[model samples]
Target: MRICLVASNRFAIREPFAGGLESMTATLARGLAERGHEVTLFAGPGSQVHPEVRLSPLAVVEVSAAAMADRFAPGPEWVADHHAYLALMLSLARTGAEQFDVVHNNSLHHLPVSMAPALAVPVLTTLHTPPLPLLESALALSPDASRFVAVSEWTAAAWRHVVASDVVLNGLDLAAWSPGPGGGPAVWSGRLVAEKAPHLAIDACRAAGVPLVLAGPVQDVDYVEREVVPRLGGEVTYAGHLTGAALARLLQEASVAVVTPAWDEPYGLVAAEAMACGTPVAAFARGGLAQVVSPDSGVLVPPGDVAALAAAVVRAARLDRRAVRAHAEATCGADAMVEGYLARYAELGQRVDAA
Candidate 1:
């Protein structure tokens, strides 16, 4: 089968990945290709090209200087990103059906969802985030334009009022995150931002009497400076942005993984990743983290409750690493995720042939 995957142009799909979305896109492209599907990925610059997966860079259009001169004009980057998606959608509208059996839209951008109906091939869009005004507006315009899949039951519920979505939890390569030597510091992984509340993780770690290592990109400089910077010292250490083996090794060495999200996370990919490494999770029971972290695998406290998180961390570390890994294998392994996607593609493939 010929498959085309549409990814975000804002960030390259290469490692150290910008986030879970990039990682998931790259993984699915390779997975489909390995399963004998002809996979073509439309990604941003510098995306890693696998042997089986073909890469097609998204066309980025430059906004005119005259357009920028308009006082009402939005930021240049926003206009540029909008243009890139518009160009991609227009291209797909022209030639997508002839080139592919189905189109998978993995971008958070509104254009793909809004313009999905124009393309001849079926579109399956995985909702990686909660409904935003822009995306909601797109959905309102063409709610039936694409099939929707949410990363968790929580995310699915978030969109239930807007549009029904199938729940498909994020999965990881468990083998790559194999159990490692533990009894080390606690681990906190993900984008270092206010929403993730790494600062709160620091406070929890301090109270838990556990040394903590924080990893991931500094997405919000102001948040980091105000909250994270002052907390960094004897109890907490910043490991900078890490990916692949470096991240896996760090998770494996940790006794527990701390996740303190101020917002309702759509899906706790980091918790799943940590559990895959046989590391128990100590996370706020918000959104999908509640679904991902089972009692046997980790401990969860109310969101922003540092005292509870601290206690939870100690209890989580006592959990058996093998059991934690077992829960991850049952719930968040790559095989299930890949198979779930393939099933959706197969349904869409049948729809295409019917058309």
Candidate 2:
């Protein structure tokens, strides 16, 4: 089957990933190609091109001076993203049927979901974030425009009021995030924004009497300066945005992985990645992280309880590393994720036949 994958134009679907969405997009594109499916990835600039999959860069439209001069004009970034998805949808509407069997809208944008009905090919959308006004409006406008998949049951429930969805847990490459010997400090990883609350991880590590290493792109400079910079010292350090083996090794050697999300994360890929490395997690029991971190693999405390999280870190660090890896193997395998999508695609095919 020829498959078209749509990812955000915000960041390229490449490492070091901007976040989970890019990483997931890359994984799905590679997984499909490895299984002998013809895959075409529509992603932002600088995405790594694989031998098996074709790369289609999201076209960036140059907004005219007159358009920008308008007081009501949207910001440049918003305009760029809107135009890119809009152009892709129009192209698919025109000639997609001749080229692809299925189109997977893996992006966070509303345009794809809103414009899906115009395309001749079937569109399957994955809900990667919480419900948004634009997206909810799109769903309301065309309730059955595309089949929807949510990354976790929590997220599916969050969107249930807007539209029902199938829950498909995100997966990681267990091979890449292989088992490791754990004896180091606690670690925290993900976008260093206010929502992630990495500073809380620092506080928890301090209370637990364990050192902590924070890694990932600092999305919010103001938040990092205000919260994280003051906390960095001998016991806590920031390892500026690691990728590939560096990030994996950091997770592998950790005594415990700390996750503190102020918002309801749609899915905690960081927790899954840490578990895949045989690293025990101690996270606030929020969103999908609650589902991802099982008893054998880690510990979860009530959200925003730094002292409780600190206790959890100490407890989770003692869990058997082998047991943690086993949980990841059982629940977070990339092959399982690939198969889940294939099942969804098959269902979509059957529906098209019936129609």
Candidate 3:
């Protein structure tokens, strides 16, 4: 099968610094390529090229420093750039669709869905963002989307009216994220943003009387400045953004993991990754966190209940690390995730062909 993958232009697809969606795209493209499918990933020029997965080089229109500085500020430039980006993605998708057996678009930004109806090939889109506007767009796009997949059941439920959605949880490469020596007391790895509740993890760790190493980039600068900064010190140590060996080491060293999201977490990738590293997770029972973390794998507490969350963290710290590792191996491993996706791809691909 010839597959064309559309990814966000925010960052290079292969850049190690690229976040979860980029990694997810890379994993699927490589996995499909290995399975004898011709896979081509359309992304920015900074994206690294893989032998198995061909890269469709696109000239990234970089937002100038001044433009970026005032991007969020009310301006005509923001609207213009947004329109340009949308146009670019649509143009790329239309051109690329002609050469592929099917199109797998990661952009839930409406344009892909808008273009899908005109394409000769079937188009499947995976929803990544939970923002209300995107949800509205997805609802509008559902009739056009051949098969819509949500990373978490929570996400699926969140937009049930917009489309018929299926659950395909986020997966990690166990070989790369396996447990290693130097495991610490506990770990909290995710964006230091309000929605992620990195501060809640800190509070939970404090209440649990455990030391935690908080990692991942500061995606929300204002939120960090207002909420996360004043609370940092002693029990909570900021390890910053970690990738590759450094990230694996951090996960391996943690005795347990904590993911306490203040909002409805669409998918708990951080929790899954921690479990992959043989570390149990203590997360809030909100959104997809409930779906991902089971009693055998980790512990879940009522959302916003700091006391309950603290207790769960303490309980997770005492869980059998081997069991945690085994659960992740069986559930969140790359093979399992890829198998699920491949099945979906095959099913949807056939549906497209039949139609």
Candidate 4:
């Protein structure tokens, strides 16, 4: 199948910016290409061309005036956001959409929904994030849109009231995250934001009498300052943004992995990645964490229960690391992930062609 993928324009695809959404987009595109599907990707300013897939950079426009207005006169914050969304939609529409068998839109923006019906091919949107507003936008704008894929059952459940969408749990490259031998302290990676609850990981580690290594970028400045920074102490070590060898090193040196989300996470990538590394994940049982974490791989506790989370961490410290590694290889590997999507694409493509 010839596929066109639309990625988030917030940052370059190569940039270690956003979590799951971009990573999944890139993963699917590359995996499909490797499987002999013709694939093309539309990326933002920072994304570079890949030999496996054709790349289209969205037309960039200067927004100095709008930036100034947003910075000073903040009447309605959604104004600037909506404006940018409309601009991208218009830019893509100008080029036409008949060039591919399917257009997979990763941007959950409402404006793209307006172009759904007009596009020559079916629009398969993967819902990556969930809040009431995003759910409402998706339902209101794309009510008739078909082939909706949710990254987790929990995410699908959140929007079940809004739209009927299929659930396809996210996948990772197990080979890239293989387990390494012997390390110290627990690791916490992913967005340092309120919803992710990185601070809870630090607190839990302290309570468990273990050191905490903090990584990932600060996604929410205000939330980090208010919740995370204040709690950082000798027990918690801030490792900052990591990539390539640095990221692998952090994962390798960790005794265990921690993911404590304050919100109902659609899918917990941190826990999945840690599991992939053959490391035990001690996370709060909420949203997709329940789906990804198994008894053999890690322990799950009630969300926000610090004592339960801490105890789970201590429990995981005793479990065999080899078993954790084996579980990730079998269940969450890239090969399994790629095969699942290939089947889905074939099924969806047949349905679309028949329609």
Candidate 5:
């Protein structure tokens, strides 16, 4: 199948990925390419995705996560650049639709979703985040609502009324993350933002008397300076932003992975990654974390309950690491994700041809 993947222009789809969405996009594109499917990825400038997958650059300049985070109140230059990038993406999708069998949009922007009806090819948009006003508004205007796919059941439930969407859980490359030497400390990995709640992970690990290693891009500098930096020392160490082998090593070395999300995470990719490395997770039972972390793989505590989280961390550390790895392999591997999307693409293609 000829597939055109639309990625966000927020950052280049290269190593040291900005977030889970970028990582997932890269994994899916590569997996499909390796399976002999013709894949073209439209991403930010300088994106170094799989050599097998064709690259179609979007933005001329890469936008950092920190800058993207300030979208609500961005400078004039930032706003102009972002709008231009969006325009380019929409134009590409509009003009290039007939060239591909399917257009899979991972770009969080609404323009693609809103424009899906006019395109010649089917557009399958995977919703990575919960329903926002902007996206919900665009979805309302979308003609073919069934093209949307939510990353989790929780996310689907949140926006079912706006647009009927299939639930396809996010997945990672399980083979790349194998069981490793695990006598190390607990770990927390994600964007260093308030919603991700890295500080909460720190508090829980400290209370449990477990050393914690925090790793990810500092998405919010003020949040880190005010909340994270003060808590980092001795038992709590910051490893900065990591990706690829570095990230896999951190997860493999940990006895347990700690996930504390302030918001309702659409899907907890880090927890799945940790479990893939044969490391049990101790995650707050919020949003999709509740759906992803099974009892055999990890322990879930009430959201924001630091005491319960701490206790759960201790219990999780004792879980069978082999079981954790097996659970991840069975449920959220990259192969499974690609298969899910392919099935959806075939179905959508049939619908488009019928139309």
Candidate 6:
């Protein structure tokens, strides 16, 4: 099958991935290509994908999330740039419709979903984030509304009122995230934003009497200064935006991975990655974390309860590392994700053929 993956233009679909969406897009593209399916990834300029997958740049130059933030307070540049990116993606999708059997939209923008009815081929929009006003409006205006998939059951439930979506759990490339010898410090990884609540992880790990390592792009600098910076040092240290081997190593070496999400996270990829690395997770029971973290692989506590999270860290540390890795291999491996998506694509193909 010839597949085209439409990625968000916010950042290149490369290492040191902007977030879960980009990582998932890259993984799916590579997995499909490895399966001998022809895959073309439509992403930002600096994207580096698998050799088997073709790359299609949506923008001439890569744009950083920080740059995007800078434009947000000044004027309409941010909005204009976003619209331009979306426009280009839609134009490419429309023009290249006949070249691919399926167009999987992971852009997380409303334009593709809004224009799905007019596309020559089927457009499968994977909702990676919760439904916002813009996305809800787009879905309401969409003529063909049956081509949406959600990353998790929790995410699907959030958008059930807007559009019926099937749940396809996100997966990680086991080869890249395979287990390593444990006995390292506790770890927390994700965008350093208020919503992710990395500071809470620091507090929990500290209370658990475990050293903590923080990793990932700092999405909110002000939050970092006010909440994260002051608390750094002693047992807590920031590893500064890690991906690929570095991130895998961090997860593998960790005694336990802490996930502190303030919002209803659509899916907790970090938790899955930690499990894949033979490390158990201590996550808040919010959104999809409960679904992703099986009892054998980790423990979930009430959200915002630092003391409970700390106790979970201690309990999770004693879990068998092999069990965590085994659970991840069985449930959240990339093969499962690719297979799930392939099934969806085939179903959509049958509908298109009948039409």
lDDT of each: 0.88, 0.91, 0.75, 0.75, 0.86, 0.87
Name the top TM-score candidate: 2
RMSD of each: 1.1, 0.9, 3.4, 3.0, 3.9, 3.7
lDDT (Cα, tens digit) per residue for candidate 1, span 234-319: 86899989876799999999999999989999998899889989999999999888889999999989888899999999999999
Score residue 182 of candidate 6 by CA lDDT: 79
Q: How far is candidate 5 from the true structure (C-alpha RMSD, Å)?
A: 3.9
Q: Which lDDT tens digits does candidate 2 get at residues 33-123?
A: 9999999999988898457889986777888999899999999999998889988999999999999999999988999999989988889
What is the number of backbone collisions in each predicted candidate, taken in the order shown? Answer: 0, 0, 3, 0, 0, 0
RMSD of 1: 1.1
TM-score winner between candidates 2 and 4:
2
Off by over 4 Å in 5: 59-74, 77-86, 143-146
Q: How big is the positional error of residue 72 in model 3, measured in Å on the Cα after superposition?
A: 13
| Model 2, global lDDT | 0.91
Which pairs of residues collide in candidate 1? none
Screening candidate 4 with a backbone cut-off below 3 angstroms (N, C-alpha, C), the clashing residue pairs are: none
Q: State the lDDT at 299 in candidate 3.
A: 88
Candidate 4 residues lying further than 4 Å off, grouped into runs, are 62-97
Q: Supply candidate 4's per-residue lDDT for 181.
A: 66
Weakest 10 consecutive residues of candidate 4 by summed lDDT = 72-81
Q: Rank the candidates by TM-score, best first.
A: 2, 1, 6, 5, 4, 3
Model 3 segments beyond 4 Å from truth? 59-97, 181-183
Tens digit of per-residue lDDT, candidate 6, span 119-197: 7777798989888887788888983644888999999999988788898999988988999787899999989999999
- Please write out the lDDT profile of model 4 over residues 87-173, one tens digit for every residue: 655655655445666777877666566567666566777777774575476567768865677778888887788787787777776
lDDT of 3 by residue, 107-180 (tens): 64566666566666777778776646744764475575557888888888887867777777778788888875
TM-score of 6: 0.93
